[model samples]
Target: MKVVVDTNKCQDHGQCVFAAPDVFRLDEAGRLAYVSGPDESLRADVEDAADVCPLQAITLED
Candidate 1:
């Protein structure tokens, strides 16, 4: 699965990180960093991350 987060829409609130730590995280500068192509086993967590993203920035593409 492929994941994409719209940086323009994201506020760096870290909701995605809490939902899917394996795929999303904060960088040294406190910016959002993520795995664009995470393992398929992480799809569910990614989906949950997308759901919890208040800014609606997370997108999942198969």
Candidate 2:
């Protein structure tokens, strides 16, 4: 799976971090960071993260 986030739309919120720590995280600067390509096993978690993003900045691709 491929994960994409629109930084412009993101608000440095950490919901994605809680939903999928393996693929999403908050940097030391408290900014959002994530893996673009994660293992397929993490699809569900990534999807959940995408769903929780308030700004809908997260996108998934097969």
Candidate 3:
């Protein structure tokens, strides 16, 4: 699966990190960082991250 997060829309609140730590995280500067192509086994968690993003910045492309 392909995961995309609109960084312009993201506020770096780390909600995606909480929802899917394996695919999302905060960098040393505390900005949002993520895996653009995560394993399929993490699809559900990725979807959850998309759902929980208050800014609605996360998107999934298959």
Candidate 4:
């Protein structure tokens, strides 16, 4: 699975972080950081993250 977060649309609100901590996180600078290519096992969690993103910044690709 592949994940992409649109930084321009993201507000650094950490919604994705809560939904999928393994794939999304806040860096030391408090900026949004994420794994572009996450394990397939984490697809469900990543999808949940994308669903919960208020800005709809998360996109998933097979």
Supply candidate 2's per-residue lDDT for 59.
Answer: 96
Please list all clashing residue pairs in model 3, or write none if there are none.
Answer: none
Q: Please give the ranking of all candidate structures by TM-score, highest first, separated by commas.
A: 2, 1, 3, 4
Compute each candidate's TM-score over C-alphas.
Answer: 0.95, 0.96, 0.95, 0.94
lDDT of 4 by residue, 24-59 (tens): 999998999999999999999999999999999999
Q: Could you give me the TM-score of model 4 versus the true structure?
A: 0.94
Model 4 vs truth, CA RMSD: 0.7
Quality of model 4 by C-alpha lDDT: 0.93
Residue 40 in candidate 4 has what lDDT? Answer: 95
Model 1: runs farther than 4 Å from truth? none
Candidate 1 CA-lDDT value: 0.96
**Candidate 3: global Cα-lDDT?**
0.95
30: Cα error in model 3, Å: 1.1
Each model's lDDT: 0.96, 0.93, 0.95, 0.93
lDDT of 1 by residue, 1-62 (tens): 98999999999999999999999999998899999999999999999999999999999999
Over 1-62, each residue of candidate 3 has an lDDT whose tens digit, in order, gives: 99989978999989889999999999999999899999999999999999999999999999
